[model samples]
Target chain A: MATIGIILFTLVVTLAVMLGKCQKKPLSNACASFAFNTEMNNLQGYLLPQECEGYVAGYVNSGQYHSDFAVAIEAARTYLNTIEADQDGKDLIVLDIDETALSNMPYYVDHHYGVETFNGETWNAWVNNASAPALDAMLSLYTDFRAQNWSFAFITGRSKSQYNKTAQNLYDTGYTGWKTLVLRLPDEENLTADEYKSKHRKRLEEEGYRIKSCLGDQWSDCSGESAGKRTFKLPNPMYYIY
Target chain B: MATIGIILFTLVVTLAVMLGKCQKKPLSNACASFAFNTEMNNLQGYLLPQECEGYVAGYVNSGQYHSDFAVAIEAARTYLNTIEADQDGKDLIVLDIDETALSNMPYYVDHHYGVETFNGETWNAWVNNASAPALDAMLSLYTDFRAQNWSFAFITGRSKSQYNKTAQNLYDTGYTGWKTLVLRLPDEENLTADEYKSKHRKRLEEEGYRIKSCLGDQWSDCSGESAGKRTFKLPNPMYYIY
Candidate 1:
């Protein structure tokens, strides 16, 4: 009788899962975990912006964000030390502008970390103001690379039209002496950031520079053909561009 | 002066997109396009479940879900027509039991679509009830394959212990005449659904079965080595399982 009851109970429970009530109201925990795992594996081609607000907020507030980047940079530093310096053409470090060199925390904070819609007009004024500060961790890494006499190049999604202001902003923010600042030409504006940036890196390689390291916040920064020998990614749960 | 201001404004607007605010909101339009592209490409990786809920909900609520499967099955039918009938060995079509063969719509509707925690006991009881209705679209496909003399196999994530009840449910629900129903054994329960399912597909291949098509709601149902020549997917936005 006991065994029969147990069997019956089990059957009933299974039936409930298959035929029970509407399990609406969202699985918050499961949703969060699933999104995190998917992003970690880069399984999805890209993330939905609406799915990022809370996730990004938590990431920025967490100390883990800084530590993750620090760990990646440390690993990169160790790897770079092993590579023998080039005597002829300089070994290069490809740096993505925007979130890579300058922190956009101010804009993100004001806008609720990407919860708001992106307005081109508002963003352009902010950039032209040149108030954005350098990312301390990346700044330190940049200084270290400079100490080793590596050439720095900025490959950004920014258009060539913003050349003067962007240049002035970079110089004012303490990232001096970059070998090249490759901006997207008007003809290449429609291409993806990955396509545009990869094209520039290939051009640089053709000009006899070996990219020793590539650093950025987006996967597109490190992906594509002619990507660097080493790549370091910073946390940017605030938004996904790719 | 107005013309100059307009030109300046255009430049700034372009620069803003290049250098401005965090573009964080989920682009529903973009998400739809990307998911469509990913599915068309049959990309190896999976989608983030959180990111797919709205899209999936829209798909199911709309008639698009049924139509999509109809198109896929139609394509398979055309392809299957080319295969010569074999007398000694039989061609096989693999189906995932839970969402593919049986519709768990009742449970999802009542439970709010997997928002709540998955209670194994409750789900087991539901399964024991053996009342899940057949998915009409898939049943028609199954019948069509049978008409061609093709064999059918079921590979599910359900534990081996649930074999008897699961079999009963499938039979009662009109998914009869399957060649084999493979369940996850105790030792294999720890593996991800993808890894375990891949193992079974490989084993089936080793046993000399030629898999012509595989159908399921999850990418795991159709990915990895020994995957079928053709794969068909159905929509499920409630939750994702690895």
Candidate 2:
């Protein structure tokens, strides 16, 4: 009976020590990193089927993504209203094409919402088809600015080969009165999105256009030199350009 | 009876029309904006009691905030590992004090997780106490790098008046062997956080320190000229500096 008591006491003490150690080390770095990345990706609407069941039903199908887009557009409108446009009729609004003015959500949806690795062939096919629709909130913002004498310039990462198709889609999607739809030339194809966009913005400035505001779903779009007077980042968790 | 039937049919038609309008306009701009702001604020650990019940039981208390910090620090570690540190001993790692190095979580918890407007009196008192704890992940990173030859520089927005207290707190929190601790001078108080931080970063560069990586909780701390070779943005949604 005394030996049994001793054994029980040792077990209890060992359990207490283990519990104390666990309390001291609440979470391992690896565990925390994994949890954080998963949660962030899920919240941002870029979860994979393996990461979460019903991936489409999580972000795109759910109205949260649309709500976030609306919020961003509203904020942009507020900022734009505060900007005093120059009287020279040279006020330009720089916009990114994919996930900004035009949403390739349909293509992304088919491609596992960016969980699948990007395929140039599939992406080019989608762009060539050119049935992409204008993001509703962005389209609204575009329509409102069109009436206000702001020149709209779409600076996209799309190759110059798809210029006609992209232009047709833009016009079909009610993006009329755009000043210019700039596509990446073959030489510029190797440049990072920031570099490519910045070059065009500098050129636009040299051409006597004052970039009032720049809007895009990626940080690369709103970064780099000549990033406009104000830059608005729309949420895009699908893919990172640079 | 026939007149009553006609009235009922008209009522049904009116109800259907109203339902259709509701479906068409699922959420108003104001409603979406408010909801989006509240949701983002909650997720980022900046929430008011009026926005949600048991506000403190959210983000910070839920361990999500710490997990995010860990994830960011992990990413920084991964990035830092890829950089080939020059042999000159001029390779400096720039750090922001508040949130990045020393967490002001205890003080922020009392201040409703930043729902309360920043109070100079209470904030200074808390700073003068010299009791802020080191953010565990950042402190671990700092300790690991300290064993190596990487020089550390803390460029903070805190006024020079609280320099001694800040230093004392830093020392007490196991942060030693730092190269320099920079505090905002009296004249720099008027400058925005970005401007002030930028000036110091440029000065660091001129002083022959190669800023390899800059880690900060706010965008302002990692932006502007001479923002180091790479900037790692720590998760801080409590308050925006700019």
DockQ score of each predicted structure, in the order shown: 0.02, 0.09
TM, every model: 0.47, 0.80
lDDT for model 1, please.
0.68
- Candidate 1 residues lying further than 4 Å off, grouped into runs, are A1-31, A34-38, A41-52, B1-242
Interface RMSD per candidate (angstroms): 27.1, 22.7
Clash count, candidate 2: 0
* lDDT for each residue of candidate 1 in B155-222, tens digit (9 for 90 to 100): 99988988998999888777788889999899997898889998998899889898877877776777
Candidate 2 regions exceeding 4 Å error are A1-57, B1-57
Using DockQ as the measure, the top candidate is: 2
Model 2 TM-score relative to the real fold: 0.80
TM-score of chain A of each: 0.80, 0.79
RMSD of each: 18.9, 13.0
Which clashing pairs does model 2 show? none
